[model samples]
Target: MEYRKFGDTIVLRLEVGEEIAESLAALCEKEKLELCQVSGLGAAGQITVGVFDTEKKEYFSREYQGDFEIGSLTGNITRKEGKPYLHLHLVFGNPRQNVCVAGHLNRAVISATAELFVRVLPGSVGRRMDDEVGLNLFQFSQDS
Candidate 1:
């Protein structure tokens, strides 16, 4: 992966064989990014995505193999116990152009290249597990 920072925004490129979530986590740690917004587009050979079942408080994941074009990738970076935490979603189109899948991102392996942008936000954000929702929700300052 290669990247250049301009002000609070980072422009990055993920090379073939790189895993999307893993790469992003590395970048966040390397740069000490606490709060940010992430977006990207690319191609992948293998990917796994999950759909949250609110009622069950669990995720049902599906894995796809073969070529796909990333139509949209969006998410955020926050801190969980001072460590970088990422929450991402993806929309991808199959090679046949007949289907597109959208869900919370699990894993994605780059097949070609991925162009990504991360915009750092001011102040910090944290996450706390919400028992009622069975998920982590963002925690903001009182002034926010």
Candidate 2:
């Protein structure tokens, strides 16, 4: 992966065979990012995405293999117990462009390249696991 920081924004180029989520988390750690917004577009050969089942408090995931285009990728970066936390969602289009899927992104291996943009925020943001929702919700403080 290659990246360049420009003011508050960081542009990243993910090479083929790299896992998207893992790479981003590593970058967050290396950069000491406490809060940020993430967005990207890319081509993937393998990916797993899931829908959250609120009633079950679990995710229903499906894996796809073969060429796919990332139509949209959006999420956030925060901290949990002083550790980097990433939450992302994706919209993918099949090679034929006849099928599309959208959900929380679990895994994505770049087939070609992924161009990602991360905008660092001015304050720190934390996450707390909400038992009722079975998901991590952002926590903000006045000083941050």
Candidate 3:
């Protein structure tokens, strides 16, 4: 993965064989990104996405192994308790026209390439563990 800052936005190029979510988290950590919004599109050979079962508080995942077009990838990068936190959602279209699957991105490997644009925000969005949900969530300034 390689990226360069273009004013307020950072343009990133993800190479083939790289996993999207993991790479982003590493990048965010390396760059010391406190808060940002990320979006992009790409092609993937393997991917796993999931729908959050709110009632059960678990994710139901689907894995696809083949060429797929990434429609939209959106999420954020923030530091939770001084650690890199990456959250993203992906929408992918299969071979058939108009047939697409979209959900919280679990894992994905770039098939060809992925171009990303991340806009650095002005303030920090930290996270802390939520005992009720057993997960980390956005913690606004006042919560700090």
Order the candidates by TM-score, highest first.
Answer: 1, 2, 3
Q: What's the true lDDT of residue 62 in model 3?
A: 89
Q: What's the CA RMSD for each of the models?
A: 1.9, 1.6, 1.9
Candidate with best lDDT: 1
Candidate 1 stretches with Cα past 4 Å from truth are: 95-97, 141-144
lDDT of 2 at 29: 89
Clashing pairs in 2: none
TM-score of every candidate? 0.95, 0.95, 0.90
Candidate 2: list runs displaced more than 4 Å. 142-144
Lowest summed lDDT over 10 consecutive residues: which window, candidate 3?
135-144
1-144: candidate 2 lDDT, tens digit per residue: 999999999999999999999999899989999999999999999999999999999999999999999999999988888888889999999868699999999999999999999999988988887899998888886432
Question: Which portions of model 3 miss their true places by more than 4 Å?
Answer: 131-135, 142-144
**Considering only N, C-alpha and C atoms within 3 Å, which residue pairs clash in candidate 1?**
none
TM-score of 1: 0.95
Q: Between candidates 2 and 3, which one is better according to TM-score?
A: 2
Give lDDT tens digits, candidate 1, residues 80-114. 88788899999998868699999999999999999
